[model samples]
Target: MTKKTLAFVVYPGISLLEFVGSRTLLGIILAQEGSPLKLGVDYELVVVGERIEEIPTDTPLSILPQKTFADVARPDALVVIGGGADTLLALEDTNLISYVRGAGECASWVAATSTGSLLLAAAGLLEGRLATTHWAYADRLQAYNVRYQATETSNTVTDGKFTTTAGASGAVDMALHLGAQLTNQATAQFGQLMIEYDPHPPFGRLDWTSFDQQRAILTPLMNRRPDRQDTVQDIAFLLYPGLTVFDLVGPLQVFSALHRIAPEFRLIVVAEQAGPVMTDIGVRMVPNCTFADLPHPDVFFVPGGTTPTLQAMSNPAIRQYIRSAAQHAQWIISVCTGALLLAAVGLLEGREVTTHWSFPRYLKDLGARYVQKRWTVNGNIVSAAGVSAGVDMALYLVSRLRNEETAHTVQWLIQYDPQPPFGGIDYQHLKLLPRCMRGIFTFVAPLYTTKARRLTRQERGRPPYDV
Candidate 1:
């Protein structure tokens, strides 16, 4: 098979999820270690735009293009992104439309997601093709002599070499389809499993009839972020063996919420390798990017797990990556005992931080001033107390990065208002528990540190490879 160049056409105010999700899913398939085909060997990936510059999106984040229209005169497959309705309507670049038409002539497959299909329509490539845009833009999609089709279960419509998908989530499905076309169904299935793409919503499907309720819930977030000049921050979350899922995902949920509103923040989950890493509780998480891929991040985040974190400190590569990334990072944040990793790398030296209540003394031993607060911030270093506290820290970070208004908007969207069934965490309430239950808590409390210490001591006398 011939080597193909997969290109993404990026623009200002484009939907980050639509663009990133498709590319990431495809990347996972291409870059899956041990696969017969490799990224640079079997295929080349490129992000193209009108110019080779950073394009700001509707969210707080900005995307950097790898190639310009002049550079990538033709690509085997191209992805044109879609954005807000008004933003898409305002985009009337003759040069861009002309390039799209010219590129489509030689491209084997031309695809668009959401309003991005409109660009293809505007370029006259969709004149006789059957396509689909976001459901809201179905009528407008027909204006270019394209047949607009909709289905309840599926979101993609493909005709010949042209494929268009509805909404942001449809990007994944479309990418999966493309993956199979590029490689094989088995490889695509493996990619899906690596990312754990199975969706299981807790509250079930939304009622389409309840338009008023749905509109009230979605309107604030659906509106385009007002234009502003800001820098994009690349945030990297460190993942390793035996990590606690909630420790990483807690703050991530908050950040993901903020990302929808203000995308100035980009989150990249990084690990030693490119594939799945198992957590302390046996849950597996696949890191989308690797340490080498994203070396210098603006924000370096670590989530704590007891056994793995201690083991991670002994690994020279983990220590080196954290140290190197820290040199360029504007902020270093941690959740739970993740503070230990930062401390291990000497980034937390003499800094005021916090950790899980069970390990405050351990944090103090590492030269950090342990404060018993929901979260602690000293200069550019921030630490959250245990797993649940990550959300508070993330919300606070959002406020610092953008504004209280933006943070509040994210908070409202996620419905962060807490109404815990057990009246929330309190040291006093612990004494009220039954003696039998207290025994169990006591047994579990020191398990993490004890196991970690054992591993550390065992490696003390041995050479690096003796393990």
Candidate 2:
């Protein structure tokens, strides 16, 4: 069978969540176990950029596209991602709009996520079509002669050939729907399961009573661009293959907003070597620099993963770097099981820390005091409970570093207001499960330790494990 190509348009200052979430779901077919579908065989996924150069995102991390607009002019499916002010700026780029218009016109499927629908409208593709975008910008669609749909209840809206989504989180829902259309419901469901797409927001559903009030307050701030400050403080994030993207992206997004308002706060992602690192999801991320490039930073950040994180605990080089970096960093932060990595390096000894609810015993075994909270701070060390908790912790960190007003501004910019479809986790009911899970980790620890030790002796040319 001839491979059908799906091209995702990427640009400067694009929202990472919208791009990553949609791409991860759509591309999961390649990673589905026992599936006949294969990359370059049944399907192909390409990141289409205006140029092949590294493009900055709304977050501190930048992305390197696999192809340029000139290289892949038209794909089977075209997905245009969105952003904040940068997206508004993208509408003015004649070259970009031309490419989107031409490619979108020819593609079998055309889709936009978050504010990306605005780009489709700018490209003159959504005229007389029903569309939706991030609620903040819903009113802007009518200017281009497009009928705007309220995304308050539905994350996605499809009008003929065009598919538009509400917010960054809606990208996942849109991708699943599109995936089902292109392949089968079974394929989409399998992909969703692979990524564990269950939604459980810590807070209850969002109240839409004040949509106009929020729109009025945030519209001007979205348009306002603060002058860059000369004074700088380096904030570094550690990157590794098989790590959870949300663990890093959640905090990174928060800090990115901080950087937007206060240029003095510089954000950087570092790895053992600089290049593409495949995430826990099927998506790939390219770090900004190498660990050796920035040995010491004002703030040192670490993200967590599943089995890979356990294996990382045994890597001597990683352990050494963390120990050395922690000595010099003014603040040390970990999200989810990243606390286990810090604990592995002996930096969390006697310190009150929190990690993913499932891994508190591991932290305690590694000689750290476990605190059951969304996030905890002890001296210069800070840790968050799990993946989503990183955002909450990061917002608090911003308040500490700058002020509550500054943090609040960043919160509003990202629409951090939580409105989970289902209420927060009921820990009381699951109390017995944690006790059972704690014992399982004891046996799981030594197995990964042995695997890591074996990996250390292997040739350095190959990756530690398949991402």
Candidate 3:
């Protein structure tokens, strides 16, 4: 039987997710979900150039070959990986440009990830086309006159034969989506389950409608972080001063005690103003209660999203006001990078704090003296790992505030059983990720360290801002 060919455009600085994700999914489908028997699907990564030439894979050691436009086998489809450096943006390779336009003119389908859409736009295939990429690259794509939807994730745009996804590993989603289309739902669902694609965000479905009220406070914050600009990394590292999860189905399921009681605690969303809070998932959240309208609660949580009101943090008057008010609040907890604000206000300092494990080393270097723990408690200040960690932290907080019985019951009511399909090693492809991302971590370390010390020094009345 003649097999359909899948050619992935592998360029420099392309996201590992796009290449690895798409390729892995195809391989999984063709290989038939770990079974001894095999299915049949032929997928290939063909980098475009003058002729067949070697292109750098996501990892430094791996090199994917480029197929010349003249001899390149007309693929059943094309998937262009993005997050490439600026050079790829200009697209000087006429062979690539020619091949894209020619193939797109002849082939039935074309797709792109993140900035890879720029290539489509460059090829003149996406003009007047509806597409999407990473939120950070929306404006860049818009400049090319491509219609943009900022909310799409992994791989999820299906505009006729031209599919586009926000690449960062979204290529994986695109891969699965393609596999599902080519094969069956069972394959796709099995793949999602196999890799534990399920998410347990502490916040609800994040979006503008959900966080409707907080738009007033959030718009400005979002404006300040148009690129996201490694804000989480910047915040975490500066606060940690590097830092750094898991599938635990052990005898003591972490929150097993919480599965036995009813929860009395209520959720309160605050903004120093009345309204919704935008979550990091590119959506806004409206908590059960608003802070301006509700009475001071026994526990306060700042969910990890974007940074809270810079006005709240930046203004000398507002900062002073919050410092005074927080003194009376029973518990002040920041999940994920939200601790950056807490520390900035002199709350988390002098107290051991914990956040998601991504920045453990940085946090300690920044003055947060602690090790790799899921939850960290320094008196009334509690911190947890990344977004999902909040579920456990929330239960733990319930247990401590109310009782173990209450926390346990709430856990049971919610059925908080986590079965990460990837298990103990979910995100273990360390070397496969692009250097740009790793460099973001490397660059952020010293920068945050400098910032943390400066903040400390300012508090100490030293040189005004140097620790």
Q: Using lDDT as the measure, which candidate wins?
A: 2
Best of the candidates, TM-score: 2
RMSD of each: 13.1, 6.4, 17.2
- lDDT accuracy of residue 194 in candidate 3: 31
> How big is the positional error of residue 346 in model 1, measured in Å on the Cα after superposition?
15
Decoy 3 TM-score against native: 0.42
Residues forming the 10-long window of minimal summed lDDT in candidate 2: 458-467
Query: Is candidate 1 or 3 superior in TM-score?
Result: 1
Q: Mind giving the per-residue lDDT tens digits that candidate 2 earns over 141-185?
A: 788999998766777789999999876557777887887776666
Rank by lDDT, highest first. 2, 1, 3
TM-score of each: 0.54, 0.76, 0.42
Candidate 1 TM-score versus the reference:
0.54
Give the RMSD in angstroms, all C-alphas superposed, for model 1: 13.1
Local accuracy by lDDT, each model = 0.67, 0.76, 0.48
* Residue 151 CA displacement from its true place in model 1, Å: 4.5
Better of 1 and 3 by lDDT: 1
* Candidate 3 lDDT over residue span 203-300, tens digit each: 22233353335334333432131232222110011111011111111101222222222112222233334333332211122223333343344545
